[model samples]
Target: MLPQERQKEILKLLQEYRSMKINELSKQLNVTRETIRKDLYEMEDKGLIKKVHGGAILNKANSETNYDHRKYTNYIEKKSIAKKAAELVEDGDTIYIDYGTTALLFAKELMSKSDLTVITNSLPIANELVNYTDFQVVVIGGTIRKNEKSLFGPVANLGMEHLYVDSGFFGMGAISSEAGYTNFHMGESEVSRRMIKHSNKTVVIADFSKFNTVAMNKVASVDDVDVLITDENTNQEALKELESIRTRIVVAEIVEDEKSVE
Candidate 1:
């Protein structure tokens, strides 16, 4: 197959399955291992995927294409992650949440709290916080990301500039040792990066599916975040890769009772 055809196939598989080994991809595409490796390298540099020891993982969601599909993809784990991340916040602490689906779950968990200073660029997150009028929600000013119902761009960053937070809760398109934390949306990425830059502590909230991938734009590295809140499906190998970089990993235990969030 042509190089573009092969790369396209590789990305399609990665987005669906998250990661694929070099040998498997080679066999499936009727290409040599060397060819697959080169393709991964090019894609990695483009921030489309993260090349691992034996495979590549898709880094970011297709954004426009998969936003809805991803919303319910890992509901249980997302809720678990969101809970664990919320535990890190004190009742009065100020926090930053982004537009990722996992972050939306985090927003839901925040609803149980009454005295929080929640700041975000996500319209969904803002709407979720509405029921808790006791919490102070700061919506960042920016252009709308219509398909995703979030805001991004320079005005958002400017809004972020004026505030500092105790914690910044973020979601990922993909994260791996090779690519760090990556995303497809530059405007959103910029907003998260600013939160990272300004927060007293930065935390990345993602499910296991995001562990080994690299997305189109980088948000930050393991060194940037103070904690990683994920779930049990995150394998040891992936944990080792993250731990190797010294990012503190917290594998959230899924609780059956929703009321337990309080």
Candidate 2:
């Protein structure tokens, strides 16, 4: 196939599965791994897709915003929520960070602080804290989920059992009055639950879009979370309901840039 045609086909596959591994693409497209890598690089240059370690993913999959196309959606809202969540962490505290895009943002905000112990199951989060000499980073080892860059399964949970943290910053695929907090994958749900169990306080970081949505697996109940930090765009009715359940909610306001219209 022509280069353009091959690239188009690859994008189509990515849209269908939301993600595709290099070897999987090679076998399906009847091409060499190097060729697939070149195609991925070209696609990334065009902003058509994102390249992960072993594969490329559709940008809309999740918030990490690195290998996904979802950065554009609720961008300001997520940043605000992340900022509010960051304020909850104090110097000389050990915190657990879950593997979610919003949680990654929280990690970034915490990087400038001094004397922190960060325990995480996210490779990206661990990498982000590597340059901060005063911060101690502990990565829970487990079976790696290539798509999300997170470690999960029995090994990860076992590792988490022995560690304790002052607080946990977690994000969810969806949150609803009925389901509480949910995730798209079962393994991710397990990791989130384990993080909550290991921490003294659990703060959930999410944007307005997460409210009223439901995912495949339940991570924790609303009661399980100590605080819910979200953006101002969240529905008032939902906020009222959360309050009725005695869930502490913090709404982060959006700050517009000076270049934008007031």
| TM-score for each candidate, following the candidate numbering | 0.76, 0.73
How big is the RMSD of model 1?
A: 6.9
Which stretches of candidate 2 lie above 4 Å from their native place? 1-67, 258-262
Report the lDDT tens digits of candidate 2 across residue range 134-234.
99999999999987889999999899888999999998887877668877666878988878988899999999888776554578988888899999889
Model 1 clashing-pair count: 2
Candidate 2: residue 156 Cα off by (Å): 0.6
The lDDT, on a scale of 0 to 1, for candidate 2 is 0.81
